[model samples]
Target: MKTFPTIETERLILRQLRPEDSVDLYNYFSKDEVTEFYDLDSFTELQQAESLIRIFNDRFITQQGIRWGITLKTEDKVIGTCGFHNWSKKHFKAEIGYELSPEYWGIGVMTEVLREVINFGYKELELNRIEAFTYPDNIKSRKLLEKSGLSEEGYLKKYYYVKQRFVDAVIFSIIKEEVTNDERSKN
Candidate 1:
């Protein structure tokens, strides 16, 4: 996609991250609770947020991946983000990542966002598979992925080195045929 795609749901908008969103991004990222399961440490500076926005945009520009800033339809400030990273067009697959403010947790926001984003992955990105990896202890994330129609694949022992230590990851994935069958069943 040449121009950034903007998606809207009943209460939220998934749009490209802008420089002005630095403050909102920093607000949640600076909180330890928000970054607890993430690979990176809690953001300590506003510049870190700014740099992250730049990297997200750069990923889209280079066709590496696309990350959308999540904001409420009633507000312009970003409250979270969800998108695909580690995209591989050749293999027709990508890894999904997301984070939301603690204040917005358990409100069905990420669930709605994932539904739309995953649809885009299959329809627009032509991806056959969408995968997510989370810390084994992140029950919330694992449950959310299951609710979103992804199935647990298995554990990857010491899959990632984060915070100066090796951490294990639980993999979840869904394929195009599964999504298609799901939609067909709903109809």
Candidate 2:
């Protein structure tokens, strides 16, 4: 709402995605490795990326949810995206989704990003809970969520139709109280 919100991490800038980012968005989304467990397939055309950006903006306008383009502070190009999808204002909950280019995989980029976004979800969005649905086979994402303090709620069979066939997902969740307690421990 209101031009959408921008969040900044130590090494990344999380901001509203623009149509101009089509090229960068296409670059990552077109990669098979990046789209492996994603709900959508690898984009074959730039128009698809552009159209997705428009959809992202529209979602913000309608208050359904928001997707932030993740860019390195020193670079002007988008390297990935992460945000809340299926957000519910009435329930104060949202599901988190994210992806990163393989080049930036091993480093701690997403860890930093997730921390800030989760904080925003709790403090700014007043979300009571944040949920994540990762493909059961996506070990990296599963570990990332657990490492970030989101506990595994359960496993859902055929929860998502990824790449064609129905795929199971592992649900992980973090509550406001969990985040608050983690913050207090750091102080």
Candidate 3:
């Protein structure tokens, strides 16, 4: 199994999910506004979040992909989760996905954490490519990807079935490059 050493950003800690963080995650996910653009169903109850966290813990040992809990250093709260998944083994490619609480939106937290995780995927995990898909309506995430130096590739109409409706997904990505290496070198 592959282990992720703890990763730190200026105001946050990117670490493996824990059972105790279920409530914080639930608090974030339970909001209609937060989950409105995200793919997951809204967390109705706190216990469901705990159950999901337990499953996330098991997933770490399995090591097929990684889902990290984004925790704030200031408040000791889990603000969101992001991960690599939907892999193509032969191609050495995988899609990255992320969601954050409404409270943390527009603060640049996800941008910092994503740059760290993407570099980890390249340098430590030996991936050649990492990409992300977002609904066309998700301008916030698209901006984050752009700020991290990814470019829009194309649009896939009805690219995903989310929230019981067909939605357009805009694909954005970064190839291994000097720019990507530049992001990797930052502490």
Candidate 4:
């Protein structure tokens, strides 16, 4: 955990977020469609992306979390990000979150990324559990979590107050043992 890990998949490279990625991050985050399910409003300025990059990197440095900037292997520009947040080493658990450019939606990009990230969480981080929460209306996210092998646990009412109002969330979780059993079955 001393150095940030870089994960690569067949068509993508998940790398550390750098200051140079602000423009790419801003391009998508500036769109209302991209932030519709996110807690933050559509970004209005470049500095907001810069601050977010700093915050994401800070989390890794503090051992609180890790977020990877997603890019295609042929290009360095970030199209989106995914990572673990609310990590608790003592509890051996963390929350997973991700967002991709709408352009990449329904194309299996996030699915591939989630597969690798989830494996890393269980193998490298030694996490016993990884969970995710999504706004109840986010059908795509809910489907993605299930496709990635997480089971829906239940609904949590008024879990977060975002955009000035309380909102409910649906939770999903996957355990290390479940993943192990899955890989065994696949083999």
In terms of lDDT, the best-performing candidate is 4
- lDDT tens per residue, model 1, 73-167: 99898999999999999999999999999999999999999999999999999999999999999999999999999999999999999999999
TM-score, every prediction = 0.99, 0.96, 0.88, 0.99
Query: Model 3, range 1-187, lDDT digits (tens) per residue?
Result: 4666678888888888878898888988888877777777888889989987776666566666678899888777789988787656577777888888887888888888898888887876677888998878878888898998788999999878878898898999887674566758994
Any runs in candidate 4 off by more than 4 Å, and if so which? none
Candidate lDDT (C-alpha), each: 0.96, 0.90, 0.81, 0.97
Question: Regarding lDDT, does 2 or 4 come out ahead?
Answer: 4
Q: Write the per-residue lDDT of candidate 2 for residues 1-187, one digit (tens) a residue.
A: 5767889788889999988999999999999999888888899999999999998888888888888999999997898888888999999999999998888998999999999998888888889999999988899999999988899999999887656688898999999998888879999
Error of 3 at 59 (Å): 3.4
* Residue 114's lDDT in candidate 1: 99
lDDT of 3 at 152: 96
Number of backbone-clashing residue pairs for each candidate, in the order shown: 0, 0, 0, 0
Q: After superposition, how far is residue 89 of candidate 2 from its true place, in Å?
A: 0.7
lDDT computed for candidate 4? 0.97
Give the CA lDDT, 0 to 100, for residue 75 in model 2: 95
- For model 2, the stretches where C-alpha displacement exceeds 4 angstroms are none
Model 1 segments beyond 4 Å from truth?
Answer: none
